[model samples]
Target chain A: MHVSAILTVIGRDRPGLTQALADVVAETGGNWGDSQLARLGGHYVGSVLVELPAGGLPALEQALRCLPDDLTVTLVEVTPEPHPPEGSRFSVSLVGQDRQGILREVTSVLAEMGVNIESLETGLEHEAWTGQKLFRADVQIFVPASLPLEVVADALEHISGEIMVDINLSEALR
Target chain B: MHVSAILTVIGRDRPGLTQALADVVAETGGNWGDSQLARLGGHYVGSVLVELPAGGLPALEQALRCLPDDLTVTLVEVTPEPHPPEGSRFSVSLVGQDRQGILREVTSVLAEMGVNIESLETGLEHEAWTGQKLFRADVQIFVPASLPLEVVADALEHISGEIMVDINLSEALR
Candidate 1:
């Protein structure tokens, strides 16, 4: 039986990092499925999905832990879940002057509203004219079918003004 | 001498599409540099950077144009620009009910303030409880050294109410 797993890795950026990881996966009879890898702040970070024979996971984990260059690897066995039924998917975006607790507050609201973040990317950019740093985030979230859009929007709207940030929520385009 | 070029391709999603493009690039002696490729809304779209011997651009373009599978290709020569000097980077995020002109209005403000957008991603999502469609956007912008943070933040803050969307701007984490 085939089993799926997620491998997360982080280390100082270097050449051949991907190849090194791939070599281990291959040796363990694992097939690379999908990955998101990037270098940020001189560090290489990535998460990859791998499929392998059910019995090979332990060996795969051991091999991954032994990779060179001080790379750290974490493995999680994943049971593929059934495809989710059709439901509402929304995109949430926020930007504000860099401050502490923005994510905490925003996520708290999401949690209270029962929104599940599917994917989120956050980064900072400078204002062209002012040179002021700004925090920005793009998020894809799944909303349950039972909630009212107004409630979620209203909840975010209520806090946005107080936080001095702009918030926009919309249905994800198909 | 080496020249850099960008290839933007779009076609119906299918296997072997990347291989076909790689084959053409290889035949033209182009070296793949980097790419962002994804399947979205049943279409395969990708932008790739390639390095080639200075004289091979025309042949590369010609070969790409003739690719099968109804693929569309556009090629542009890219002159690498020097990295911008260290300046503040900011993140901008926005969300509102899906509507026309949100981008136009928001971007207009940025342009008027002389902010430069480094990256922008936009999408729609449905509210989980309400099923209301929301429009969302995330943007990375470069702030010039001369502008004050308040000027940009205040500008967006002024419009958030009128636009019925939330907008936040913050300094990006280094």
Candidate 2:
């Protein structure tokens, strides 16, 4: 049987960190299927997906544990996924003053619309000269196309009006 | 003042989709920012981020109305967003027979852990020879360091065991 594993390496950023991870997986006969490596805030974080023979998991886990303490490892076998009976894709963006209730309010509206938010990212910006606080977010949602688009839009507009922010709902490109 | 718009276009797959989109945005004085376009089934679905002068929205809305009846358009204004608080990022993958509860069960665990999924995609696979079912999902999440890593692993394992599927969580490389 095929056994899938995902390994993450985190430690002070340094050369050879990825090599160390690759070495461990290789030693256990794990096939490195995919990985992502990036530097964030001066720290090195790496994630990899590996496929191994069912018999090789123990060796892989044991090998990973022997690595440095700064590098934490957790593993879960792959699982079955379910497909929605119906779905529609949407894009949502928000612009407003920084406040705590924003995400809750916006996501609540999405939930009521039976929308599944597939991707979301938020960021804060200060006017270079004014230092004024501004919050922004972009979210992509999957909803059923059979639903009236207007209902979703109206819900978002109502929330935007209440929060003194701008909220938009449109079809996603892809 | 700047006005942000989310625009999406979908129709029978054809070559002029991009040009049509660009023409509409250009004529409306809108700057296209982010976009995703792909063919799903026999139709081309596209989503775009655009910024325009506040006064240009009406014209853009009017111009978009000229599209074919099969095309659906949604436009909304939005506010700025702020960055998510700092945290760790992880990758999640699930594979199993296709069904519905998988998303709810898996996301519920993340929600309880204060982990935020950044992006997620799910799909189904059919065995070429046996015609059996296979479902899979890949999700990337941002997890606060304060959340116990073991707890997450356990939750995923439980879901996997119950669903007769596989769930893997690995540290994100970036």
What is the per-residue lDDT of model 2 for residues B21-123, given as tens digits with 9 covering 90 to 100?
Answer: 5567777777655444443333444455566887888998999998766565555444443344666778888887654445556666666677665555555
Task: State which docking tier applies to candidate 2.
Answer: incorrect
Candidate 1 regions with alpha-carbon error over 4 angstroms: A82-86, B1-174
lDDT of 1 by residue, A74-148 (tens): 666664454554458888888888654465567667766776655555666788989987777666666777888
C-alpha RMSD over true interface residues, model 2: 16.2
RMSD to native, candidate 1:
22.0
Q: Is the docking of candidate 1 incorrect, acceptable, medium or high quality?
A: incorrect
TM-score of chain A of each: 0.95, 0.78
Q: Mind giving the per-residue lDDT tens digits that candidate 2 earns over A146-169?
A: 778788888889989988998877
Which DockQ values do the candidates obtain, in the order shown?
0.02, 0.02
Candidate 1, residue A90: lDDT: 84
